[model samples]
Target: MSAFVAEPTTALEIESIGNGTGLWLPPEVRDEVERVQSGTSAAELTAGVVELRNLIGGSADLFHAAMLALMCGTMVEHGAEPGAAIDATLDLLVATLNTLAEDPDEMARAASRLSIPAAMTMLARSKETRKRWRARPEIMDRLEALEDADLAPFWLREVFTLHDDAPLLVLDPNNRRAFEFRLIGVRDRLYHCYALLQDALLRHTGPGYLGAEPVDPLAVRYARNDHLTPADYRAATTLGDHQRFAFAYPGIAFMPGSGTPAELPTVDGVPLLTVSPKTIHFNWRPANMYGVIHEALGSSIDLIRELSPADAEALLSRCALP
Candidate 1:
């Protein structure tokens, strides 16, 4: 479904999401839009985009991030928000993103749908930020203004980016650049149900947050080598203000950050919280689930030997998975 009318119920995450302090705005977009839009007449700007589109022979995803952003801006001007397109889709995207097994690139189409909604949220934030800047002249110099006084900058900045080497945008108006990172969707939003597990994993680490080592032998076998050891993401902030979204990965539905969903799969003695990452994504093996075993077993993780055989079985059981 493109966007849902009935919203699914979900439990709340424990600690509210945290963010690294920085400008939410992506600068490349801001600069390029400012360059093209300023000085150049509006007609010239549209002509340039049309020229660029003709030059770029192909685009992988169904939509263009820049155009989608522009469309969002246009909608705002008409006094409407993307509405359910955002509210319903955003929740589904976030949950899908949390899965352990999903293709990032395949998620492109779904991710593209989120552009307008996400843009609206950003526009609202931008307006408040701008309001503050106007009220206090002392801080105006420190602020980064995307557009002169219009809402277009908030949406178009990321689309009309200038980076030649950045892997994310994949926007090659001229066909000279080599392909790099091929995201299923725009960097900020979830593309498919599997939007950002690795992204979800990156956040839910460190002492209390907890990440597993794919300790299950079957799980270890299926996991990609790249994911086993966490990479030091120089730019973890790509999700932008969306970072506040709870546990954006798949497999484990109930994170300490996000509490348990009301409906769970087969529970022999306890609540099934974790799903076998390998099985769910592949859809070939027996659907296996783990109970809220980590806490039930008395400690975080001491040893498998310590648990009785029956207790272990109860900890992990076959069940329906998302």
Candidate 2:
């Protein structure tokens, strides 16, 4: 229901596979990787349901080897530097593959199909790699110009105050510029990947129970004068709250051999999006990436423009998580 944009989820491609260097992928693994990398978006993974089953039932060594090969190849193709950037990416790939290897179908149903916390942590590490790049005076000038141009709408507002009122994870205005850009990139990547994974689950399982890994719930609060009843509070914490609600259209029906009967339907309470975190409460869908970001990072672009590259870098260095 939220408006958002997304990029394609690019699958990593491996050129060679082996236990050691100069090794080549076995015939079966090579075919699978090639088929997957060619055009199959992760969202379209359902199309490969047969292939997934085959891989799962096949030799574990072959599957792991193929995945590692793809990852290593993708790294080489991108010419990714051998530091934190490449390392973090490989780690995520490893974790994803390992989870899949353990139980392909179960994990396939998971929201994000990997880990959100790990992604945030890796995002912080990736930001660190850009420290020197953000310190450049030209980049700082660019940051200032961006604030003046793209963020003109927010120029009159106080940066921190605005951020405090919003759900976005934003850098302090005094932080470095590169970190903000990296954060944006990482956010986009996370959203796209998760969407692909969620889509895959939907396609494979249809409109049934698609279980998700638990995540932090967005704290939705009501304001004064917004009437709240005990039922509303109870419903908010219960699984029943996941149901979508809307105003009913009034209508009347004529009764046979009798006068017209007026139908009055009484609707109770206001509609709100709610979710219970962890199994202690109830089973409900996790918030989609767009919803999470929409709640957390509203007007984040405007806020980022206020930050100097130096200030952004410093802020990132101090944070353990994004």
Best by TM-score: 2
Clashes of each: 14, 13
lDDT of 2 by residue, 1-322 (tens): 0000011111121122111233244467566555644533433332332232233223233223233333333333333222323333334434443444345442221311222222222222243333323324432333344345432122111111111111122222222222111122222222222222223323332443224432222212211102434553454453111211111111311111111112212222211111111133222322322222211122212122324556545544544213
lDDT (Cα, 0-100) at 28 in candidate 1? 68
Lowest summed lDDT across 10 adjacent residues in model 1 is found at 291-300
- Candidate 1 overall Cα lDDT vs. reference? 0.26
Q: Kindly provide the TM-score of model 1 when superposed on the true structure, using C-alpha atoms.
A: 0.17
lDDT digits (tens) for residues 194-230 of candidate 1: 1223333323332222222322222221221122212
lDDT at residue 294 of model 2 (Cα atoms): 16
Candidate with best lDDT:
2
lDDT of each: 0.26, 0.27
Q: Candidate 2: lDDT of 20?
A: 26
